[model samples]
Target: MHLDPRLSFLSGPSVMAQLMRDKDWSDSAVGPPQEWPQALRSVVNLLLGSAFPMFVAWGPQLAQLYNDAYLEIMGAKHPGGLGRPLLENWAEIRQDVGPLAEQAMQGHSRYLENLPLRMRRGRGEGEEDTWFTFSYSPVQDESGAVAGMFCACIETTRTVLAERDLRARSEWLQTLFDQAPGFAAVLRGPEHVFAQVNEAYRNLVGGRDLIGRSVADALPEVVNQGFVGWLDAVYRTGEPFIGRAVPAVISRSTGEPPYEAFIDFMYQPLRDAAGRVDGIFVQGHDVTEQHRSREALRQADRQKDEFLATLAHELRNPLAPIRSATYLLRSPAAPAEARNRATEILARQVDHMARLLDDLMDISRITQRRLVLKRERLTVAAAVESALEAGRPLLEAKRHRLQTNVVDPDACLDADPLRLTQVLSNLLNNASKYTDPGGRIAVDARQSGDSIVFTVSDTGIGLSESAIRTMFTMFAQEQTALERSEGGLGIGLALAKGLVELHGGRISASSEGPGLGSRFVVELPAAPAPVAATAASPAAASAAARPRTVLLADDNSDAAEALAELLRLEGHVVHTAAHGLQAAEMAVALRPDVIVLDIGMPGLNGYEVAQRIRAQAWGAKPLLVAATGWGQEGDRQKATAAGFDRHLTKPFDPQRLVDLVGES
Candidate 1:
C-alpha cells in the first residue's frame, strides 16, 4: 500500500481513491495528475472524497473520475472505468446521457429525476434496463472556462420496477371485480359515493351513470324505499346487512313506470387499516321470478289440501244414503212398498255418485288432453231440453222459478251434444244451488249472427269481485259458497269452462255484486243445418222379455252373479264368469248370443278377452259389451277398438243391461 504523493488529494479509505492512486494516467486525455490544473485537480479531489455518488469528466475527452459511492452504480464497469471518457465506458447509454454531458461541458447544468437508460451494469455482457435521479453541472478550468462535466446520481431502478408491478396487480383485480355474475359495487364515505361498479350493477340500475354519485342522487327511488336508509345504517353501524327476497320498486328507464322486483343482497362494511368504517361493499342477485314461483307453489299446496277435504266430504254424502238403501233392501221384513222406495233411493244415490265421479274423470281427461268430444249437428232446442231435464230436480228442491226462451229453436250447432248438455246443466245447477229459496232463474238461447249465445241468469247470492277473478280456476271457491251446503266441489264452473272451450266456445260470468245476482253467457259458433237433419221420434221403452243366451264377466263375483240373475229374470239364458279368462273360454264353448265384459277384470282384462274371442269365427255373431267403471270417452273408443259392440259404465241400470241382452 504505497501511496503516490502526486495524487495525495485522492483521500479516504474509499476503494476508488486507492485505485486512482495506482493508475497510469499518462496516456489519458486528461493526462497525468502531476500536469493537471488546480481547478481540475480540486474538482477531482472533492469528487473522490465525497460520500454521495459523484463523477467528474475533465478535458475535451471528458475523461471519467468518480468517488467510492458511485462504484455501485458503475457495477462491473468500475476500476478500469476510472480515467476513461464518459461515452467510452457508458457506450450503451451514449444516446441518452451523452447530450447531458455535452451540455454540462458548455457551462450549462441539468437535473433529471428517474432518467431511464439501457446500460451494461451487471457481470453479464447483456445490457439491462436502469433508472437514476441525477444532476449534471459544469466543471471549469483554471482560466474560468468550462472544460468538463460533473454528475451527482443515485440508481432508482428498484423503485421504478416495484411501482410497475403494483400497477399491473391493481388492473388485474379491477378486471375480476367487473366480471362477477351478481351485481357488485363499492360505496365510499358516509355520503355513500359510488366508487366502483361492475357491469351487472350498472345494468341493475338501468345503465345509468353511477360512479362518483351518491346513492340518494343516483337512485332517488331507493331513498324512499328505505334502501338508502339501510345503506346509511350499514355504514354508521359498521355491520353487514343481508336481505333475502326483499322487494324493491325501480324504474328501468327514465320516465318509465316503476316495476316491483325481489332481490337477495348484502351490504358489507369496509374498514380502513385503523378499523374505522370507510365504505361498503355491495353484492346481490335479482330474484323476482324465483320469489313469484315460490309463492305460487305455496298457494297450489294450500288449494290441494282444501280440495282433498272437500272431495272426502262430497263422496261421503252419497255413500251414507246408498248404504242405508242397501241395508233396507236386504231386510226380509221390509214391505214391498218400502223396498220399492229403497230401490228408488238407491238409484238416485248411485246416479249422484256417478255424476261426481264423471266430473272428476272429465277434469282429469281435460288436463291430460285426452277428452274426446262426440260432436254432432243438432237443433239448439234439443240440447236446451236435455239440460233442463238434468237440472230440474235441483231447481225444484230450491223452489227456484225457471224460465227458458230459445229464440231460434232451429238454430243448429256442430258440437258435442252430451258435452253441450253437460255445460248448460252445470250452469243451471250452479245457479240453483247458489240461489235463495224461491229465487228466479232464466235461460235465453238465441242466434245473433253466425254464433249462438246462451245466457243463464239467476237471482241468487251472487259473486263478489274477488270471487269472479278466481271462479274458473280449479278448486277455487268463494267464502260464501264454502259456507253453504250446496258449495259442491268448486269445480262445476271450471268443468263447464273446460267443456265449452273444448267445443270451440267461450263462457263468461258477470255480476252486479254479492246478493245482486249473476249472469253467465256461453257463445258457440252456429252451423248450417245438415241436409240430412231430421227430428227423431223418441223410442218407446220395450219390455226386457225376449229370450237370448248371455255371458257376463266381472272380477267382482257378486257383480257378475247379480248381472247374470237380472238377465235371467228377463227370460234369457244367462251364465256368469268371475274373470276375463273364464269369459273368453265360455264364449268360445257356448257361442253365447251376447257377452258383457267388465273392462278392469284381471286374468286377462276384458279388452284382451274381447280381442281373443273376436279372433275366433263364432265370436263375430256374439254381441260384445264393455261394463266397467272406466267411463271416459277415450275408454269407450278403446273398448270399441277391442271389438266391443257396446260400452256401458258399471252400476248401469239393470234394466238397460237386460234390454241389451234381450235385444241380442
Candidate 2:
C-alpha cells in the first residue's frame, strides 16, 4: 500500500496504527489526517507510541483512537472499533464515562480509580462487569480551545475481585471465633484494654459490656487476686500461662457479693509482624462445678475409710467379753449365781450385736430401694409402747428417768407399724446412750392439726453445730470423747431419717448448746380420711398335733441339728440332711409331710432341689420352706416360683419354725 505523505505519522509496527493508515476517513466525524489540526495529530501520535493502555476520544462526535495495548480492553470490539465514536463502542458505560469525557473537553482534567463498567467485550458472551483506572486530559486546538479528551487507562478487575474475596473470608473467620465453646477474649497493650470478646466471654461475666475497658477496672475483684498480675506477666514476657482449677472471687452481678469460682484458663501473648508482643489472648472454661464434684468424692472416700475403721473397732469390742463368758460357763466348779451372771452377759451382748447387724441391713435395703413397707393403720400410743419395751433395758441400765406424756394417745397413723416402732426405738436408744446416768428423758406425742408430732427431749451431752449439720448423713458421727464411744455405730439416726422420709415425714434435731440437752422432733402427716375396718375374726385354734415326718436341710450342721431337735420336741419325727442332694434323696425315701430347705446349699441350690422335688408325683404332698440369708422380695418371689410354700431369712425365730412344722 502506498501511504499518503500527510498520514506518514501512522506508519508504525502497531496493528491499530496500520489499520488507521489504510482507512478512508471521508465520511468520519473527524476528517482524514491530511486536514486534521496539529493538536489532534499530536495526541493520536502520542496514543499509538505508548506501551501502556491509552486512547483518544476527539471532536464533537468523540471519534475513538487507541494504542495496541488498549486492544485487550476492547475485547471483541477491536479491529472494527478503530474508527468508531467512543459512545458507539462503549455505550453500556456511557453513564459513567460520559461526564468525565465532557469535563475533559471543557479544559478540565478528570481522573478516576477502579471505575466500574458493564459492557460487551467478549465475542459471544453477554455484557459483564469490568473495572479500570484511567484519566482524561483535554487536547487543545491551535487556538488554545479544547477539541478532544485523551484517556490513559488500565484494567483493575483482578485486583478488585481479590480484595473483595479476602474481606468475605475475614468475616467468616470472625463468626467462627464468636461461636467458640469456651470463653475467649483479646486484650491490647500494657494496660490490657479489652479489644474483643466472644459470646461466651460475655456470659461468663454476666453480660457486662467490657470492650475498651482495662482488665483491672473491669474486674476489680480479681485485681488483688493475682489475675491482673498474671496478665501483665504474660504480656511482658510474651510467654503463655496455663492454669487448672485456679480459684478466683468474682462478682457476677451488680451489687452482689463476690463468689468463689475455679477456672481452667490460658493467657497467650499475641505478636505483630515484627515479632514484638502486642496483646494477650484469653481462653478458659468455668470449672467450678467439676472441682466441687471432685472434692466431694475425696471427702466421701475419707468418710468411708473412717467408717470401716469404726466398724472393726465396734465388732471387736464385744468379742472379748463373749469369750470370757463362754470360758466361765465351761467351768464345772462355777456356782449357780456365777453361771446365771455369765448367761445374762451372753444374752445382753448377743442382743447388742444383733441390733447392730439389723441396722446395717436396713441401711442397705433403703439404699437399694428394696425395703417394702407393710403399711397398716395403728394408734400412736401402741407404737410408743412397743418402742419403750424395746428400749427399757438400756434406759434402766443407765438409770435414766423416762417420762411419757401421750396427750393424744388415740392419734391414728397410716404407717408400717414395724418401721414406725423401729424409728421411735432408735431415737430412744440414741438418747439413753448419750444421756448421763440418772438423767431425765421425756417422750411426748400429740396431734397437731393434720399431723402427728413426736418430741423426744433428753438431758444429755448436746450436739455441736458441726455435728447437727451432718448427723443424718450415713456413717457420720459426733466428735465425742473416748468415754462417749459407746454411742453406737452412728448409723441409727441415718437409718431413722431414711425410714421416716419413706413414710412422707421429716425428722430434725436441735440443741441449746453442748451440755444443755437436745430435742428431736418427728412430724408425720395424719392419716387421710380413715378407712372403715372390718371386725377381726378370732385366730384359728392350733390344729391338733399329728406325728408327721419332717425333713430339714442346711449346710450349717449346728443349725440343721438344732432345728431338727426343736421339731422333734413338738412331737414330729424329724430327719436332717446336710446338703441339697441328700435332702432330695431323703425326701424321696421318707415322703415327709414337711421339708425345710436352705436356699444356699452345696451340691445343688435350693431352687433346683425344689424344682426337682416338685417334678416327682409324691412331691405335692410335702410343704416346702426356703430358709436362707437372701431375704429380698425378689428372693421370696423366686422361692415361690420354684415351688416352695414359704421363704424365711437366716436366724428366723425357732418358735416360728416349730409352729410352721406343726401347721403342716
Candidate 3:
C-alpha cells in the first residue's frame, strides 16, 4: 500500500534524511522505512530529524539509519552507510557496541560514558580508537514489543584525548621540577603564595613548610635581606631579577644563630591569561665553597711573590763585596797587605755564593725525589767534627765562642755522611748568625738507647713558640728575622729538616724565648747490630793525569771558556764550540776522547746533535757526556735515551768535570 503524501520520507530537515528518501531500499534486509511497521518508521524519522548524532538499528538484522550529524561521524562511509547492516559497516566496533544494541533489542535501555570503540570511518582503511558517551533505548511497536534500538551518541574523542594528554603532561612536568639538581619553586597569585615547590627548593629553605604560603610569610628570615622585595618587584613589574654570590643567612637549626651562604639565583614573573603578573618562578644554586677556594689561591700567589723578591735581595747582597775586591786585585800597583786582603775577601765571597747555589740545588733535588744519597756506616764524632770544620769560618767571623763535648765518641749512624755533615753545618751556621758577638755555641753527641742524639746549643736570639713551630717551613721567616742587615733565604733550616728526615732522623728546636738562647737536637737510628761479615775497602783510583782530547759544546762563551781552561789546566787537549752544529762538526774532525754537550744550544740543540752524532760511524767511539743546566729527571732520562754516558748540571764543580773526563 502507498503511504500518505504528507507523511512520506520527504518530511525531514537533515541532508541524510533527503538522501535516504531518494535512494532505493528494496535490497536491504529491513527493506525501506516507508514499508516498515509504524514503530520502525516513527523511530527512523525521529533519528533522521534529530540535530544530535542519532541512529536507529531496525529489525532483526539491525539495519542502520542515521541523520546528517551521524553521517558526519561516519565520515566518507555516508552514502553507502544507509540501509546496510550496522554490524557490516562498522565491523571493527561491533564487538564493543554490538552488545549494547542487542540489550536494547531485548527491551532494555542503557547508558555508557566514554565507551572506547576501535573503528575505521570514512574511506580511511586503518582502524583507530574513538570515544563517545551514548545511550541505547528500545524502540517499541504498537503492541509494546521491542523491534529496534534507538541510539543517541556524542563523540568525545577530541575532548577526552585532549584532557588525557593535558593530565599526562602535567605529571611529567611535576616529575622534572621535583628531580632538578638546582633549587626550583613556583608561586601563584598577587600574594606570591607558593603553588609548587621541589625537593631542592625545600632544602634551600631549611625544610620549612613553603607550599600554599606567601614569600614573606614562608621565608621571613630572608625578607630583611631583600630577597622578598626582589620577588615582589618581579611579580609587580613583570620583569626578572638575577643575583650572583648573594649572601643569605639560613638557620638550619631551631635555636642556633643563622650561618651565611652564597647563592646564585633568578626570579621571573609569572603571568596569567589576562597578561597580568601573578606570581614568580624561582631558581638558584649554592656557590659558597667556590668563592672560598678562589680566595685561598690568591693568597698563595702573593706569598710566592714575596719569596722571589727576598731571594733576589739575598743573592745581590754578597756580589757587591766581591765586585769591589775584584777591582782591587786588578790594580797593577796594589800593595802586599791590600792585595792579600782583597784576595781573601774575593775568595770568601765566592765561597758564600757557591754555598747559596749549592743549597738551592740540594733543595731542588730533594723536592724532585732525585737526591741519590751515598749511605754508609760512620761515627757521629767524625760527622760532627767535619761539620765544625766547615762552620769554623762563620764562627770566627761572628766572634761566637765554640765548645764540644761527646759523651760517646763511638756513637754511630747509618746515613749519607756528606748529607749529614751538610745538615750539621747548616745548624751550626744558623746558630752562629743569630748569636751575639762573644756568645757561646756548643756541639755535643751521645748514644741514647738505639739512636744517636746530637745537640747544638747556642746563646743567640732565641725563638718564640710560634717561631719554633714554623722555623722549618719553607720561606717561613719573613716576620722572624733577627735583623734586616743579617739576610738569608729562609730555606736553610727547611733544607736541614728534609735531609735529616731522609736519613731516618728527626731534628727539633727548643727555646725559652727571644734572647734567651735556643737548642737544636738531632736523633738518628743507630747502625744495626754488626754482623761478622766483612768486605775489603776499595782504594780510590787517581784521576786521569794524562792528556786526552775533549770537545766542549756550549752556547755560553764564558762558561765554555772557563770549562776549557779548567780542563787544559788538568793537561787535556780541549776544543770548544759555541753552537751545536759547530761542535758536531768539530767532533768528527777531532775525534776527541769525550764530547761534552750542553742541552740548550742555538740551531741543532743538544738532543738533535746527539741524535746526528750517534748515527755517524764515529758516534759511539767518543764518550758522550750531557753536561747541562737542565737538571730535571725527565731531562736526564731523555739524555740517557739519546745515548749520553752521563748528565751533569751547569756550574758544576770544576773537579767533578775533570774526574768525569779523566775517567773517560
Candidate 4:
C-alpha cells in the first residue's frame, strides 16, 4: 500500500506509520490518510506514538480512527475498520454512544468510569455486558470549531467485575451523578454542602472549585436571588421543587460580568437506605435564548393589539366631525350659508378620512412585501416640490416657520417620484403634528458620497431617547392605544422606513433630548439620469352626476345615520338599517336603486345579506356595494364573490359613492 500523504509531515510515527505504508485506506469514509489535513494528521500521529488507547471519530459522520492499542481492544474488527463510520461498527451499542458523540461535536466533553454497553464481541453469548472508563472530548478543526469527538477509553470489565460487591454504594452513585448531562451537584445535610459536583456544575460557578463547598460559599451571588432559600425549603420539606425558565444572574466564566440566564431546574431530596432525607440533588438546564425569543413575540403581539385600538379611535375621530356637518346640511330650516359651510366641512373631513385609508393600504402593502416602486429619472426638486405641497396646509395651520435648502435643485437622481415624495411628506407631517404650534421646520436635500441625502429637522416638541428609538417602529405605542388627541394610528414613520429601504436607502431619527427638537435623515443610492417621458395632460375632474334612492346597512347606528344624511344632501333618497337581517328584508320590500352593506352586523352578516338580496326575484336589481370597516384584500375578494358590484372601505369619499350609484 502507498504511504499516507500526511505521514511526510510527521517527525516520527510508529504503528500507523507502518499501516500507512502497507494498508489500502482508499475506500474509507475519511479517505486516504495521505489526503487528511495537517490538524487531522497531527492528531493521528499523537494517537499512533502514544502508549494510551486513543481513538478519533472525526468529521460530520464521525468516521472511525484509532491507534494500535485501540485496535487491539477492537480485536477482530481492527484490520479492515480503519476509516468506517463509528456508529456502523458500534450499532449494537449506539444507544450509549450516539448522544455522547453528538454532544462532543457540540464542544462538550464527557467522562465516565465503568459505563455499561451491550455489545456483540467475538463469540459473545448473545449481547455481552461491557464496561469501560472513557473520556470523550471535542476535536477542533483548524478554525477552532468542534469537528467531531476524540475518545480515550480503557476496557474496565475485569476490574469492575472483580470488585463489584466490594465497592461502596456511594461511589457508584457518585459515578452516576458525574455522567449525567446538564448541570448537576449533590448536596449533603441541611447545610447543603457540595459533596460531589460534575464538570458542568463546576463550570456554572465560573469554574471555581465547587467540590466539598457549601451552596452559600460557592455561589454567594445567587443567594440574594433566592436560590439559597429554595434549597433550604427543599431540604426542610423533603419535596422536589421544579422551576422552569427561572431568571438568574450568574458568573458563567471568570473575568466576565454576571450575565442574565434562564434555567429549568429541579431540587430533589435524596434519601439514605434508612428512608430519611440525606441530601438534595440539583439539576438544571440553561434556556436563556428560548425564553428571550418567546418574550419578544409576546411584546410584538401586545404592540399590534395597541395599534388596532388606536386605529379604531382614529377612524371614529373624523367620522364625528363629518356626522355633525351632515346634520347641519340635512336640516331644511338651515340657512343657505350654513348649508354651504357644512358642505365644505363635510368635504374636508371626507378627504382627511380618505388619506388615512390610503396610508393604511400603503403601510399594509409595504409590510406584506407587495409594494413595487415605479422608478423614474427626476430631479430631487420634483420630489421636494410634491412633498412641500402635501405638507403646506399642516404648516400653515400650525403657523410654523419653514425653511428649505436644495444643494443643487437641478441635480438629477433616479427614484420613484410618488413614493419618494410620500417618504418626505410623512416626515414633514410627523414633525408638524408632534411639534407645538408655531414651531420651526426645515427640509434639505443634497448629493453626499454615492447617496442622495435629505434631512427634515423640527423645532417642535423634541423627542425623548425612548421615543426616538421606537418612533419608526409599527404599533410601538399600541397597548393603551385608544386616545390619540394628536390623531392617527402612529403608522407614518414605520411606513416611511419600509419605503426608504425598498429604494436601497436608509432613514434614522435623532434628537437632543425632549423639547430640544428632532431631526430625521434619509439617504438613497445615487444613480445616473435616464430618458424622461413626456408628461401627460391632467384629466379634468368628472362633473357631479345624477343620484338615485340608496339603502345603507350597518350595525353602528352613529355611522349609519350620518352616512344616510350625507347621501340625502347628494340628492339621493336614503334609507338606513341597523342590522344585516333587517337590511335584507328592506332590500326585498323597497328594492332601492343602490344597496350598501356592512360586513359585520347582528344576526346575519353583510356577505349573507348581499347573497340573499341578489337571490330575490326583483324586476330590476339594485347595485350592491360593500361599505364596511373590513378593508383587507381578502375582504374585497370575498365581497366580489358574494355578488357585490362595488367594494368601498369605511370612511370612503361620499362623492365617489354617489357617482357609483348614479351610474346605475
Candidate 5:
C-alpha cells in the first residue's frame, strides 16, 4: 500500500495539472477526481474550488492540499507548508491570528483585513517586515466533516500609513488656520472665487456671507481697483506678491461710514504636486489707528511751531518802537520837555507790550507746570480792594460804575496774596473790557462755612452755553457779531483756574444768557485762625501813613522809569536806573528805605546787587526787592536766599510797586 517516493511527488503535480485542464471544460462535464484516495482527493478538490488561492492541512481522516496559486503566493514554502498546522508554519501570526484559525477548525469561516504578519523568510539572512489581509475558511471532507483552515491573504501596509499621515497633517493645518488673528482666505479656480475664509477674514469682509462667491461678486469695488485681477495673475503665474501700506476703504451694509484701513499683506499661490497653480492664499493686517494717530501728532507739531514763530514776530514789532523812543530820551542834548514827552509815550507803549508778554509767559508757565503760588495769610477784602485799585484805570476808561458788597470784611484766608489779587484783577479787567460804557461791575464776598466766596459780577454781554462750556479753556474766546474788537488772549481764566487749584480752591463762571450779565465765583478755604479786627482796615490805615524813598533798577529802562514816576506820584521819592550799577550807587548814597532791583541786568544782577548792598556797613540797610520776570517758586526762593526781602514780577501794578516801596 506504500507509494514510491517519486510516485507520491508526481501524484500532487499530476492532480494540479489535471485541475488546470478542467478549467477549459464545462463544470457539468467535470466529475470529481475518483481514482485518488478520498482524503487526498477531497483536499485537492477543496483547494481547486476556493474563491481565493488557499492552503489547508488536516490529520488522519483527511489529507492536506495546496493550490498552484497558493504555492506561488507562498513562494519557497509550497509543498513543505502542506500536512502542517497553519500557525506552526507561520508562528509569528499566533497571538492575534490564533482565534481566526480556531474558528475555521470549529466549522466556521473567518476573514481578517490588514492582519499584520511578521514572518522570517528564507530570503537573504534576516526576516522581512510584511503586512497582509488574511482570511481563514474551513474545509470539508467527502462525509461533510470539518478539516483544518485554508489561509488566504494579501499585503496592505503602505496604504494604511499614508492615510494616517494625511489625516494628522490636515488636523494641524486646520488648527493653525483657525487660531490666526489676521485675516486669511483661500481663493480657488481661475476666477479667484472664495473657497474658504477664516474668522478674521470673515470679519474683514464686512461680516457678509462670502464663501463660494467670486472675488468680483463679493467686492465689486475691489474688481474695479484691479485687486481681483492681481490675485488672478498671481494664481495663473504661480508667483508670490507682497504689498505694504496699501490704503483701502471698506463700506459695510450697516449705516456706518466707510472706514479707512492701511493694509500690509501677501498673496501666495497654492500649487499642485507638479507645480501647477490651483489656488491662492491671502494674509493681511489692519493698521488704521496707527496711521491716524501719527497724522494727528504731526499736525499738532506743525501748529505748535507756527504759534511760537508768530508769537516771537508779534512781540518784536512793539519792542522796536519802544527801543527807538528810549534811545532818543537818553540823548545828552535832548530837551527836558521833549524828553519827558518821549519818555511818557515810550513808557505807555512799553507797558502795553510788557503786559501782553507777561500774559503770554503766564499762559506758557501754566501749561508747562512752571508757574507757582506764593501762599500767605491775607484778608479777602484786601485782595478785592487791591484788585479794584489795580483795575481802576480800565474801569474808568470804560466809564463803568463799581459796587461793593463785602459783608465779611474781617474774614481772612491762607492764600497767595499776589496771586489772589491777580485773579481778581483779571476778572475785573475782563468785565470792564467786555462791558459797555456806564455798565455796573460789582465785587462781593461772603462767608460760607469755613470758606469765603468772592464773586465778581458784571452787567456785560453774557455767555452762550457753548461759550460757557469752553470759557475756561486756553485760547477760547467769546464770539460777538456786533463788536469787532479783539478779545484777550483767553488765558486769564485758565491761569486763574490753575492758581486756584494750586491753593486748593475752585473757581467757576456763570451767566443767564447773551445780554444779561456774567459772574465769576471764587471759593477758598478760610484761615484756621480767628479773623483780626484790624484786618478790615489795615490796607487803608497803612496807605495813609507814610511816604519813603525808593530806588528802582531794571534792565528795561521804560518799565523802571514808569514805575519810578508812578511811585513819585504816590508821594514817595523815587530814583530810577537803567542798570544795576546806577541803582547800587544811588542806594548806597541815599540809603533808600527800599531798593527794587531787576534780576536780569547787564553787569550786576539783582541777586549780586542785593548781596553787595546787604554786605555794606551802612547805618540803615535798604529793603531789597527782587523785580524780575521769573516768578516760579524756585525763583522766589533764590531771591529770598540772596537777601531779597520781597519778589515782584514784571509788569507789576504801579500802586502795588508804591506800596512795596513803603508808600502803603
Candidate 6:
C-alpha cells in the first residue's frame, strides 16, 4: 500500500513480527508449493530484501539490498523494485549517481555530493524529484559479480536561498544610506561612535574618515560644543532631541574666515529588536542664509529709528523761529501791500516748516506705536468742508477750481475731528499743488453699505505704477526734483494712514498712471450725530486782554522774555520764572492770575512745580496753563493730572492763548 509523506515510520517491533510471519509461511509451505521453481523463490527473497532501506535497489535487484530506514524512505516500492535495474526505476540519478552506481558494482564504495533522484512506487504512479546526498556502495552476489547500489542523502536548498535573499536586501539598504544628503550619521553605544556616516557628514567634517570612531575623537570640536553630552543623554534614555537655528563657527585648516553656520538638527535614539537603546541617529541642515536675512532686517530697523530721532531734533529747531516771525508779521499796523506780501511769505513758509515738523512727529509716533486718537461723532460733509476751508488759500493761490458733491450730506462718523480734517486737507493740498492752473479738484462723499466714503479727485500729475505701490510709505513720493522743490516732504499719506487706522477707517489711492490724474478715497464707519455748523464765535475775538498777574516760567530765556513782553502788551502784570524752584518761589510771592509753566525743564519740571503750587497754603492758587512743546496724548494726561487747568503746546496760536488767559 502507498503512504503519504507526512506519516511517521512503523515501530521496529511491528516490522520484525511481520517479517517472522512471512518466514514461517515460506517454511510451512505444502509439498506442491515447496516444489515450486527456485526462480520464483528467489523473486520472493529479492522482494523481502528490497523492503530494507539504505539500499538503491530497483529493477529486480532489490534482493541484494538491506536496511529498514531505506525501506521506509521508499515505502511500498519494495516488492515492485525487487531485482530491477536501479537506473530504470530512479531515472534522476542517471548522470551523477550512474557513475557511482557503476563504481559500486565493481566492488568499490562511492561517496557522492548532494544529488537528485526520481522514485516510482507502483504502476501508473507519477514520479517526484528530491534533492539528496547520495553515497553508493557495491552490493555483490555470492559469486562476487556486481549487483546493485546503496545511497544516502540530505536537503540544503531552503537554507541556501534564504541566506542569498538576506544578503541582497542588506546591500541595497547600505547603498541608500551612503548616498543621502544633509549630514546623516549613525552613532553607536553610549560613547556615540561614528558607526556609519553618509557623504554629507564626511564633507562637513573636512573630508575626514569618521566611521568606527567616537564622535569626540573624530570631531573634538563637537565635544567642546556640548554635542557629545546631548548625544549621550539621548542614547541613555532613548529620547529624541531637536534644535533649530543653532549658531556655530566652523574652523578649517585652510586660510579662510571662520565660517558661521546656523544649524537645525535632530538627535534620535536607535533601538534594537528587543527595545534596548543602542545608539543615536543625527540629521542636520544649514540655515546660514536665513540667519543673515533676519540680521539685515534688524539692522535696517535700527537705522530707521535713528534717522527719525535726528530728523525731529534738527527740524524742530528751525520751526520755532519761523513760527514766531510769522506771528510778529501778522500785526495790523503794517502797510497793506507790505503786510499782504509778508503774510503770503509767512503763510507759505510756515506751512512748509509745519509739514516737516508734522512728518517727523508722525514718524516718531507711528514707529513707537504710540499714536492715539480722540474720536467724536461728526458728519463726513462737515469734515470735508473744514479741510477745504483750511486749504482754501493754497487752492486760490494755485488757481485750482474746488468742487464739492455730497450724495450723503447726513452721513456722520466717529473720528478725531482735527486729525480727520488734517487727513482731508493733506489730500486736497496735494491735489491743488500737483494740478495745473485752472484745473479742477473735486471732493465727494457718499454712504456705501455701513461705511461713509469720502473721495478727493484731482486733475493733477498722476502717479506711476511704481510710485503708487510705495506712495503710502514714509518718505516715498512720485514728484520729480523740480516738483519736490515746489513743496512737499512726502510723508502726508503715511501720516494719513496711521490716523485713519486709529479711527478704524481705511484710506486708498487710485490712478490711471502718470498724466491721468489721481483719486484718494477714505472710508469710515457712520455714526448718529447732527453735523454742527462751521461758525467762528465772537468770543474768539475778545483777545489781547491778559490777567492782572501772569507768572511765566521757561528754561529758554529768549522764549520766556518774548512771551512776557507779549503778555505785558496785553495789559498783564508779568512775573518770570526760569525753572521749577524759581516758579514755586514766584508763585508764593507774586500770587499771579495765571501761572504759565514749561515742561521739560532741568531739575523739577512743570508737572512737579504745578503739584507744589497746588499743595501750598501761602497764597491763592493761580490758573495753571501748561505751555510746553510736549503735545502727545500722554503729555496732555500728565499735565491735567498734575493740576494744570489748561494745556497748550509750544509755538501755539497766540490768539488762542490770549483768549484763554482773558477768560481766566
- TM-score leader: 2
Give the whole-model CA lDDT for all candidates, comma-separated. Answer: 0.87, 0.86, 0.83, 0.82, 0.73, 0.70
lDDT of 3 by residue, 218-259 (tens): 877888999878877887788899999899988765786888
Candidate with more favorable, higher TM-score: 4 or 6: 4
Q: lDDT score, residue 589, model 3? A: 89
Better model by lDDT: candidate 2 vs candidate 5? 2
lDDT of 6 at 622: 75
TM-score of each: 0.74, 0.80, 0.60, 0.56, 0.57, 0.53
* lDDT for each residue of candidate 6 in 1-664, tens digit (9 for 90 to 100): 5432222121133443244233323322221223423433343344334443344452233333334444544456664443345665455446755676667767798665544455444434676544455566654444555545455544433544465568878777778777765778899988888888888777665777678889878777667676888888898778899988887666543555566678888999889999998988899877778877887677557545744664565466556666655665777676677666666666556555655665667666876778777788888778878998988988999888888999988788888898899899988988888888899999999989889898999988887887777677765555442253345555678888888877788999999977889999998888877657676567654533434688999999988898788877888888888888898888888888789999888778999989988888743357899998787768889999999999886667666666767777
User: Using TM-score as the measure, what is the rank order of every candidate, best first?
Assistant: 2, 1, 3, 5, 4, 6
Relative to the true structure, candidate 4 has a C-alpha RMSD (angstroms) of 21.1
Tens digit of per-residue lDDT, candidate 2, span 1-664? 7778788778788887887877788778888878888888888888889999999988898899899999899888987777689988888888888888888888899788998888788666688877889999998889988888899999999998887788888778778779988889999999999999999888778788799999888888889988899999998888999999999888888997878889999999999999999999999988989999998788778778877887788777777789988899999999989889998887777666766777887898898888888898777798799889988988999999999999988778889988998999888988888899999999999889989999999999989998888789888777762358664677888999999998999999999998888899999888754466876344433453667788899999999998888888878899999999998899889989889999889998899899999999988889899998887778888999999998877656677788787777
- Cand. 3 TM to true fold: 0.60
**CA lDDT, candidate 3, residue 510:** 96
Top candidate by lDDT: 1
lDDT for each residue of candidate 5 in 1-664, tens digit (9 for 90 to 100): 5544332322444445444333322222222233344654555565665556666555432234566666555555545555445555666656766777667778888777765666655445566666667777776657777745566666566765676678889778877886687888898888888888888877776887788998888877567665777797898788999877777777665677776677778999998888889899998877667776886577557545644654665567667878877887779888898788787877677676777777777777777777766777777678788888889998999899999998988788998887888888999988888888999999999889988999999988987887787667665556661263333445678778888877789999999999888999999999854445545478767655678878888888787887777777877888887787777777878888878889999788888888888888872367778888887768889999889988887666666666666642
Residue-level lDDT tens digits of model 1 in 569-634: 677888899887888888888898898899887889999999999898777898999998887778
TM-score of 2: 0.80
On residues 1-664, what C-alpha lDDT tens digit does candidate 4 reach at each position? 4534456643354665676556687676677766787678778777877778998997887888888788667766666666778898788888999999988999999999999887775554577887999999998878988876889999998888778855766677777767777789889988899887887777666788776888788887898998899989988888899999999899876678888889899999999899888899889877788898898788778778877887888779888888988899889999999999998887787787788788888788788876768888888788789999998998999899999999967666778898998899988987887677878899999888788888999986676776777778886642222222367767888888999999999999898976788899999987776566865333312223556778999999898888788788878889999998899888878889899888988899999998898787872378899988777777778998898998887777766787787676
A best-first ranking of the candidates according to their lDDT comes to: 1, 2, 3, 4, 5, 6
Supply candidate 6's per-residue lDDT for 594: 85
lDDT of candidate 1 vs native?
0.87
